[model samples]
Target: MNLENAQVQMRKGILEYCILHIISRGEVYASTMLEELTAAKIMVVEGTLYPLLTRLKNSGLLDYKWVESSSGPPRKYYILTESGRQFLSQLQTTWEELQFSVNEIVAKESKGE
Candidate 1:
């Protein structure tokens, strides 16, 4: 099996959910968002994040406002919309269920079940 590809696919599957969780904390700048994701070893580039953020915004799951920066022209800060919050709650529930299932499988395998 292609282990590396599988790992990448697994990360990609949860990336959107992680991004939403991050934004649900508060309104955040794009650069800051990139930093948090990078620090978590989830995503690396503005290129990847920008498109996802735009898509989320377009879907009415997120909203943003341009905030003037002291060192830069302006930055778009994002926040979860009402719909976004609801969607995120659902994601959290699904994530918990999936995590539990995966852990159960791992435990069974480790025990040679």
Candidate 2:
């Protein structure tokens, strides 16, 4: 198995969760989101992000509003909907559980169990 492939798959699995968490904080623009993701080393391009944003909106998990920008055209700012908040809460719980489980297994293995 390719190590890089496995690492990429792992990152892909949590990308949406991370995105949701970011948007949940407050209304955010796509470019701002991209900068945050890049700063955190998630390294997503605009091509990947827009489609995911659309998918989340279509699924009723997110909504956006057009904001007039002084520099140029209006920008869409993403915000989490009620359903999105509930969904994110559940995902947070699952993330904690997975973290605990994985750490426990790794700890055991490291101890030569």
Q: How far off is residue 99 in model 2, in Å?
A: 0.5
Provide the lDDT at 37 for model 1: 79
Local error of candidate 2 at 37, Å? 1.0
Candidate with the greatest TM-score versus the true structure: 2
Measured by TM-score, how close is model 1 to the native structure? 0.92
CA lDDT of each candidate?
A: 0.90, 0.94
How high is the lDDT of residue 60 in model 2? 99
Candidate 2 clashing pairs, residues 3+ apart or interchain: none
How many collisions between residues are there in candidate 2?
0
